[model samples]
Target: MSPVPDHGEESYIGSDRLKGRKALITGGDSGIGRAAAIAYAREGADVVISYLPEEQSDADQVLEYIKKSGVKGLEFGRPP
Candidate 1:
């Protein structure tokens, strides 16, 4: 099967609309959830992402991007 396509990786300019906000996102290891986490961070919000343990690698990547936004980033793993 083909890997899921995620267009959220495209560069997005943030306007600080979500500044000082905290976001909790599920299924954030990939796809739309990952994209939202990136967007939220760029918008100046702390981000927490939850996903299946199997998706830890992907979640790590998203967390890196989130941290680059100069906001806090957290990862939660659910039992498979």
Candidate 2:
């Protein structure tokens, strides 16, 4: 089996540097949360997103982007 890449070889995503961390992103279905999702992935942190139930379309798009970031995307919401 192929070996997984190590953290040492990863590039820094932002000036803030959030390596080896996990973030629970609120309002993550769109806007800032969407942006943060990708940024956090590049920064080497796992991300989970939460948003309102009515925004499923937007949320789906955000989740798609998050997936492209190579991280997991979780959705949490109520019926709208």
Candidate 2 lDDT over residue span 1-80, tens digit each? 25742222134345336666788888876666667666776665667778888887877776666566566666676464
Candidate 1 vs. true structure, TM-score: 0.85
lDDT of candidate 1 at residue 48, scale 0 to 100: 95
RMSD for all candidates, in order, please.
Answer: 2.7, 10.1
Report the lDDT of model 1 for residue 2.
68
Candidate 1 colliding pairs: none
CA RMSD (A), model 1: 2.7
Residue 51's lDDT in candidate 2: 82
- Residue 30 of candidate 1: its Cα lDDT? 85
User: Which model scores highest in TM-score?
Assistant: 1
Give per-residue lDDT, candidate 1, residue 56: 82
lDDT of each: 0.86, 0.65
lDDT of 1 by residue, 1-80 (tens): 36856535557768899999999999988878988889898899999999998888888889998888889998889563
Per-residue error at 17 for model 1, in Å? 0.7
